[model samples]
Target: MRRFVFGALAWPPLLERVLGRAADLRPARLPGYAVYGTGGGALDPGTLCAVPDGGAEGLLILDPDPEDGARMAYFNGTDADGMVTEVRCGGDLVSARVALHDDAPGDGALPWDQARWLEEWGPLALDTARNIMAQYGQTEPARMAGLRPYLAARAWARQLARTPAPAEVRMATTAEEGVEILRDRPGHEGFFRLRAFDMRHRRFDGAQSPEIGREGFVAYDAALVLPYDPATDHVLLIEQLRYGPILRGDPRPWVLEPVAGLVDGGEDPETCVLREAVEEAGLTLREVQPMVRVYASPGYSSEFFHCYLGLADLSSYEAGVGGLDAEHEDIRSHLLSFDRAMALVDSGEINAGPLAMMLLWLARARAGLRAGA
Candidate 1:
C-alpha cells in the first residue's frame, strides 16, 4: 500500500479510470513542491517540480489497487525524478511520494489553476484517459504524451457517434429503444485504432436479432474539398498511391481524389478543408460551399467526411506535384474540364467515392455556384 499527494492537476475521476477502480480523493495540501502546465499547452497535462516554500492544493489517494500498478506507472511515470518527501495537509505533516516529468512546464512556468483546468481541459483530459489507460503495458510514456492530442480527438469522435439523432427513426435508432452494447473493448492502438464489440440490436419488422459480434476501424473524421472554378470551367483532382486499392488487389492503385485530410481535435470542418487545400495542392481558397457530411463506409468503418465544393480561380492553375512530406504524401494535381471529369466518372475511371459524390453534387449545384452565389 502506498500514498501520494496529488497536486492541483490531480484529476480524481481521471485517476480512477487509470486505476480501473473507484478511488476516493480527500482534500489535501502538499508543501515544498509545485505543479505547472507542461509546454504541450494548457491541456497537455502537468509537470511537477520541487520548489522552496511553494505548496500545492490537491487531493490524497492512499492504498491504490495493486493489480494496476504497472498501468498506473504510465500515469505517475517513473519515480526517477521526484522523491519520497513530506507534505502538510490540514495542519498535519505526512510522508508521501511525488513524481514529476522533465519536459513541459515545470515550476514557475504557469500558476496551477485547478478550477480553470476543470472548466476548460477537464473533459478532454478525462476522455483522453480512456484510450491512454487502455494501452497500459503496451506503450511508453513519451509515445503516449505525443499521442495525447489525437487520442483526445479520437475520444471526441467516439462521443459524437454515441449521440443519437433525435427521433429520426421512430422504431428506434436510439439505443434506448432498439440497440444495446453489451461489451466494447479496444483491439489495437496507434495513429489509428480498431475497436471490438459484442452486442444485440433490433431488427426491422419488430423483432430482436440474436447477439452478433462485430468490430470497426476507428478513424478520425475528415474534410474533403473538390476545388472548382466556374470562370475556367475546371475542377481539380489529386492523384496519390492508395494502399487500400493495392491491398484489395486492384491493378491500378494510384487513386484520384480530392484535397482531403483528417480533422484535428477541436477544429472546424471548413477550416480543415482550407488547411488541406494549401498542404495538398497549394491552392488558396476564396470561397467554399459545403456539399455534405457523411460516412466513408458504414459497414466496416467509423470514418466520416465533410465534403466541400471550394470556389477558386483556376485559369492560371497548372497541373503539378504537391503534398506534405512529413506525411509521406507524394501527390500530383490535375485540372480537368467539367465535361472531361464527368466523362471519366461515367467511364468508371474516377472511382474514389468522395470525388465522385462531389462531382455529381457539383453537377446539381453548378449553375447556382457559377452565378457567384
Candidate 2:
C-alpha cells in the first residue's frame, strides 16, 4: 500500500485507464495493489502511509475555492528514487509528488477508516494513469503538461479533416534482374531495370515474356511532365530515340514526346518536372503549375504519371540541343504554336500519350490565353 495525499481533489477517470495498463506490466508481475486517501482532519482515511518498493502511488489536488473547478493529479512513481511523474488526462497534466513521513499515533491527518477510492473512480482514471505511467520521467510528460488539451483537440480536428485516397500498389518486378542482367546480358549495365508494363487486354503476361523468369517484372510508379507558355502560346516538344520504339519494330525509331524524364528515388515530383524541363528542352521555367495527375496505364501497370504545365519565356529559349551526355540522350526540341502542335497530334506525328494530353488541354485554354480575357 502507498500513501497518497489527496488535497481537496476528486479522482478523475483518466487515472483508471493508466493503472489498468500498468497493472499488466507491473514490476515483476506482482499481485493487485490498493490506493486510498488521507483521512480524519482534512484528508480521506484510505490514503496509504507507506508505499512498497514495487507498488504505485497517486495524488489528486483541487482548488479550495468552490467556484474554481481546476484540478491537478499526479502519479507517485517508484522507478527512480521514488520520483514524482507528470501525465496528461482530462485536459490537465498532473504531476505526482512523493514524501516519507512517520505514522504518529493520534495525528489529525491520518485516516481512521479504509474507504474504496478505487471502486468509485477507478475506471475513470485508467487512461490518464497509464499515460502518466508510460511517460514517467520522459520528455513526453513535460511536453504534455503545456498543451495537452490543444494537442488532443488538434488530433481530433485532423482526424475529421483527413480524407485518405486509394493506396498505391507495390509489386516486386525485378530485384534480382539487375544482378542477372549484370552477369548474363553484359552490354547494358548502365541501365538495368525491372519495368512493369500494362497488359490489360494484351496477351503479354510478364510470366510469358522471355525477358522475365521466376523474377517477374515489378510494378513501377510512372513519372510525367508538360511544358507550356501562357505568353507565346508556344509549347516545346522533344524528339528522341526510345528502347520501347526499337523493341516494337517501328520503322521510325525516334518518337515525339513532352519534355519529360524518369523520376529517381528521393526526388519530389515538382523537382523532377523542373529538372526534366531543363534537361530535355534547355528551358528554365519561372513557375510550374500542376495540371493533372493520372496513371499512364492503370489496368496493367503501376506507373502513375504526374503532369505539369510549366509557365516559361519560350520566345528566346527554343530549338536548342539539350540532353545528358552520360545518358546518350540526343534530344532535339521543336518549338511551335499550340495550334500547330495539336495539328501534328492530329496528323499522327505526335504519338506520345502525355504530349497529346497536354496539347489538347492547351487547346481548350488557348483562346482565353491569346485574348488575355
Best-fitting candidate, measured by lDDT?
A: 1
lDDT of each: 0.75, 0.49
**Position 15, candidate 1: lDDT:** 71
Q: What TM-score does candidate 1 reach?
A: 0.84
Per-residue lDDT for 1-373 in model 1, tens only? Answer: 3346453236777778777887755666667566775434324445566667767666666665565445555654442434566656567777766554543444457766677777766666677677777777787777876676677677767655664445555554566778888998768887678889998888887788898999988888888999999987899999999999989999999998999987766567799899999999999988898898788898988788889999999999888998988889999999999999999999999999889999999999888777863
How far off is residue 4 in model 2, in Å?
Answer: 48
Candidate 1 lDDT score at position 368? 77
lDDT of 2 by residue, 209-305 (tens): 3343222222333345566677777887888888787899988888888777655432456787888887777788887777767767754443556
Name model 1 segments beyond 4 Å from true: 1-9, 30-34, 38-43, 49-54, 64-81, 102-112, 139-147, 162-172, 184-186
